[model samples]
Target: MQQLRISIPKPCTQNWADLSPAEKGRYCSSCQKEVIDFRGWTADELQDWFANSNGRVCGRLSQKQLDYFKPKEVRHEGWSFSAKVLLASSLALLTSSKVYSNTFAKSDSAIHQNTNEKGSKIKEEAKPSDSLIIIKGIITAKEDKLPLPDVSIFLKNSSVSGSTGDNGRFTLQVKATPGQKLLLEFKCLGYATKELEITPESVAQELELEMAFSDEGLTMGAVVVSYRRYPLHKRIWNFIKSPFVKHR
Candidate 1:
């Protein structure tokens, strides 16, 4: 029986793992014994070789070798323009979910209490006169100049309260006795709360409250709120537009 022989190409010292079992017993011509040559080059080595040769030489695998090991072309479903747009939009929405969710959570907690004071104060002497307090304000967003709806208003220790309608307007009536202090709490979904202290003088006149949102809430979406009070001229302008506003 004749012994099998294998040939080693010049300037190539690496062994290929994808060889047939019979070819594994190849001998190097430079060294006269049956030996397996193994000095496998990595992708980096190939790139370096090409770079050093100015794209002239291949380190271990030639273009022919590469072609031999090249992968077959795979058929894939083509994506339409709309599909691509939808995919990109979905990815954007997913990435922004955390931002939106955090804003919502903070807004929800904005009107909440930090600590509790369980009991109410007893009526004190030297009480001042009791007067009707009228409070009104526009609830505006902080970012995009949009209106917030369904804002709740609470007057501490009193049954007087109200809410902002769809256009972010609210009105409330409150009464105060001399030497008495009152706390007002304002709340809205996805917005920060507003708290105000009321005195007897403020009770007889109309008062405007400005609400500011938490910093985190302002980052997620369009916030279009102005501070509760507008300038005198601005109020007049708004009033002129009131007829149009009322029709809506």
Candidate 2:
């Protein structure tokens, strides 16, 4: 049903009428304004055209088929010749484009991973304040039957906080404040802070400060000192005063 006008060399017309039905289907002579009879074109028809033309079909041939049709002298117009060259060049570029795309994608992925690792290492090596501490314990009433795992453990007055780990465990670290009271606040999401007053003395040893779930949980326990006390500000001042300290 598709119709196209073909300008064949006048010398070609002598052999053109002998073209198979399929070839005739692709072209029609305008001289008599009559339809050239050729059967429906398909793979076999195309192959016959190539064979009968002594393997000289050019533009309609696929890239793989072009080697058979290479001419001793160019018969197609200059513009048509340029168009074929451009098409072949374009196909070659397209075939290799994936390699470049894949190379770029791999490079980008490596850079992203390296960046994440470098950022993580910087964060980990910076200071103890940003570090984490993992702890496991039961949140229980002195004489209660069931224990709760979802306790809200927080540093006093700060929004930075954590919840109990699975199996009633939790971990967090605040900036090392030597003299400042490090309050151990164990409050079930709906419960209250079983405030255990920690001085420098009692920080190291495993502790069990008994507290109630009710308001009556407030109680002052016996002092237990485990680690020697040194104020953080004093340490920083000493580091600054030392002649060995390098200035940036």
Candidate 3:
């Protein structure tokens, strides 16, 4: 008997859509050699296979499947790369504006506080000293104990003077140094003038004064007197004869 030899048929290269389901699962020498399948497979399966098989997948895919899995070129809205940059810049500007506004507000508050402090300091420096003593008192009639209005109250031998108010109260400011003696005089119509000595220790206290009525009235009658002198020649003859003639 002669030796027999049979040749196996090679698998046909067909698209995934043209392969029958039974043929799609069958092993092919070409696919086994290539280490990949050319049959029906989902996009997910292809992606998974590609990942696991070092970027290998089915060589043939259906047109519909390819179209479904194809990456579409997305059309961006009006916002582009430059628009994004502009938007980010705008946000940054707004944030800086808020920060600057807060800074300005704090600075303004500090400036106002400093101004007030300076004003207070200036006022303190400009304030008058306590050496200027205030003398306040009431003037009244000694006989009637009634308030005397328009009574002149003044420092003795000084031009500074104050008049009593309707309430008979008078206030006078006098510069009295430490350990200095002060003399205040009170004068009024129909009243005897009064003087009071003020010491530094007693200057702060209010004074109460009573004035007595004057005994000498203001009205006085005028007196008239006339005198006649001898002539110069008659006075000289008299003077010359009086020495020679003795009085009888």
- Write the candidate numbers in order of decreasing TM-score: 3, 1, 2
How do the residues 85-149 of candidate 1 rate in per-residue lDDT, one tens digit apiece? 68999999998997888798776665353222221222443345676657676766554345556
All candidates in order of lDDT, best leading? 3, 1, 2
What are the models' TM-scores?
A: 0.32, 0.28, 0.35
Between prediction 1 and prediction 2, the one with superior TM-score is 1
Off by over 4 Å in 2: 1-137, 189-192, 209-248
Worst ten-residue run, lDDT, model 2? 217-226
Tens digits of per-residue lDDT for model 3, 1-248: 11111111232344322233333232334344221322234555644444344322233333343344443343444447557878999999999999988799789999999999999999887635437778888887665466777788889877779999878899988776677788888877546788898876796778999987553432111111122343444445566877674321
Off by over 4 Å in 1: 1-128, 203-205, 215-248
lDDT string for model 2 (176-206, tens) is 5445566667765223457766654445554
C-alpha displacement of 156 in model 2, angstroms?
A: 0.5
TM-score of decoy 2: 0.28
Which ranges of candidate 3 are over 4 A from the true structure? 1-130, 219-248
What pairs collide in candidate 2? 21-38, 165-169, 201-225, 201-226
Task: Please report, as a residue range, the 10-residue window in candidate 1 with the lowest summed lDDT.
Answer: 218-227
